[model samples]
Target chain A: MAGYGTARQDHLRRLRRIEGQTRGLQRMVDDDKYCIDILTQVSAVTSALQSFALSLLEEHLAHCVAEATRNGGPEAQEKIKEASDAIGRLVRS
Target chain B: MAGYGTARQDHLRRLRRIEGQTRGLQRMVDDDKYCIDILTQVSAVTSALQSFALSLLEEHLAHCVAEATRNGGPEAQEKIKEASDAIGRLVRS
Candidate 1:
């Protein structure tokens, strides 16, 4: 959890900005902005989001799952399951 | 970048565990582990990864992109572009 906190804070900040970018994208749409321009922003937001996600995924694997395995048990197995599901959602999303 | 440091460490830790799970999965495959069991582990890793990604995206939106927008300029737009592209990759990957 301690590991998650700092990371969580960082993620929160990034998300907020992405939120604004999304709004801007909406405005661009509303104002009849150029297709390329809108697409460009869309691409940017997407990349930003991916980078953020990557960071988190990395941590979950390193800390959470690793700790579980080290501790050893059914819970560790459960943790592994949980992590895999998360990746699936990310890919699909 | 300062914000990224603590977050990065957390991510690294999680990644290590996911890596181990992946190895286990590979072994399971080699050992002819049950299909359901293998898939289940895969799903778990995926979910964990996604959770991590989500957190990072959130931070990017809140801090980096927000700062860019608040500062106001082409850089912000560029940053927006960067972020969007990232999300696109995440979705596709």
Candidate 2:
């Protein structure tokens, strides 16, 4: 679907950018940047990354998961289990 | 790397389960399940999905981003930028 494609593209772009920020944070450490400054950036990066994940999760639930559940069956049950385990990991982290 | 592989495998398993949860939610809707109950499950599913994304992002930062930044250069900078944008999107969502 066009909508899915657009969303995916956007998601990919954002992910790539996050990947870059992560690298920047590492560089800060290596360059011996001020501890406070590094920590601040690190915090921002963490929050930013967390926010992105939240968005994707929201979308997945609203669309993919919702649609699949509507159809109902073995596949649907599998998806629910998959989601539960995934969530468990996230919360644990 | 073996570590990455193990982590990836774990992540994949979680994702698949979440996928199943979403489907279950859909079935509930079709079955005309109670609104409150459905909403409860939906909320749980949302939380679970978010957790999965967070873990992946954390890993990316700890392993991929950190390593790339240590090596330093255009590639590292690029990765940092990618991460930033991704975080921005996540927060926005």
Candidate 3:
């Protein structure tokens, strides 16, 4: 079970939308869309993905991290470190 | 014809890969993958899309923007403005 269990359905919905956006991007490229227009579409897709990630991260923190820290063990520290690393990756990516 | 004419095939290839990545993400979420693992994959997909956008933008700068600027007319300024706005959207996204 993942921290995002409660939000799994929502996550799936978001992913499906993103997948559609990716297909839209392919169509834009294939149809010889203007450079600026394609870039705008890409930006929209990227933003959608970012929002999905943020929502997932929030769920993870609220569930997994919260549970670990509540237990007050070595796993708590490990979870914090892991979450920080994930956040770093998201920011730098 | 757009600025990325020479790179259109490459862009299609990249978008196809991104589409695959997005589907993989859906699988990960569906499989009850660990939260951190899923987030890491999301970061990877986001990075891949960023690289795609940057490459397309570079091609636009070199092809369309360069051609417009070389013409040294009102449209030249217009193209520069349009490109700058696209860049701004990419950055904010």
Candidate 4:
């Protein structure tokens, strides 16, 4: 977690921007925008969320997973499993 | 795109809620929340987006892809390819 401390603000800012994008998408739909336009917005939102997820995953790997592996115990195994599960879900999504 | 017309409003509402969640996540980080707690929120956001993507993909497959397959032309081929590419990216993400 401490490892992520430095990048925390950056991630927060990115998420906030994404939040605005999501709201804009909602407004587009509410306004009865063109079909392709709406779909394009959906694609953009999906890509933004995917990028965020990838960054978070990278942080988790470099910090939590690395620490757990270094510790070398049940906690390490649990952490690895948790990360694997997350990756599995992401890929499936 | 017309196929999605019926469910458009539903999707918009869902996206709006996700936007709120994203803003909340930003607030959590800004307030210096606990690491694990923030991570849990991240996981929730990821899951929400994943579900949205899955639903959109399903709609594309059932309506867009099915229509394209029925048409049986170059446009059909293009649509099929587009859907396949989208699915590929979603899975990779």
Of the two candidates 2 and 3, the one with more favorable TM-score, higher being better, is: 3
Using TM-score, rank the candidates from best to worst. Answer: 3, 4, 1, 2
Q: Which residue pairs overlap in candidate 4's backbone? A: none
List the candidates ranked by DockQ, beginning with the highest.
3, 4, 1, 2
Model 2 compared with the native: what TM-score? 0.47
lDDT of 1 at A58: 59
- lDDT string, candidate 4, B1-93, tens digits: 355567887887788788889888788777766445555665677667667667766776777777878988898888877777766665554
Off by over 4 Å in 1: B1-93
A65, model 3: CA deviation in Å? 0.6
lDDT of 2 by residue, A1-93 (tens): 311333555545554554455456445444544333443454554454455455556665666667779999887787677667655544543
Per-residue lDDT tens digits for candidate 1, residues B19-55, read 9989999999999999999999999998778767766
DockQ of each: 0.10, 0.04, 0.86, 0.34
lDDT of 1 by residue, A1-93 (tens): 644566887899999999999999999999999999999999899888877876776566445654665566686667655755565466776
Q: Top model by lDDT, which number? A: 3
lDDT of 3 by residue, B1-93 (tens): 887877889999999999999999999999999988988988888888889899999989998889989998999999999999999998988
lDDT of 1 at B49: 82
Off by over 4 Å in 4: A1-5, A27-93
lDDT at B68, model 2: 75
Residue lDDT tens for model 4, A10-62: 88778888888888877866775644455555567667766766776787788
Which of the numbered candidates is closest to the native, going by highest DockQ?
Answer: 3
Q: Which lDDT value does model 4 have at A79?
A: 84
lDDT score for residue A15 of model 3: 94
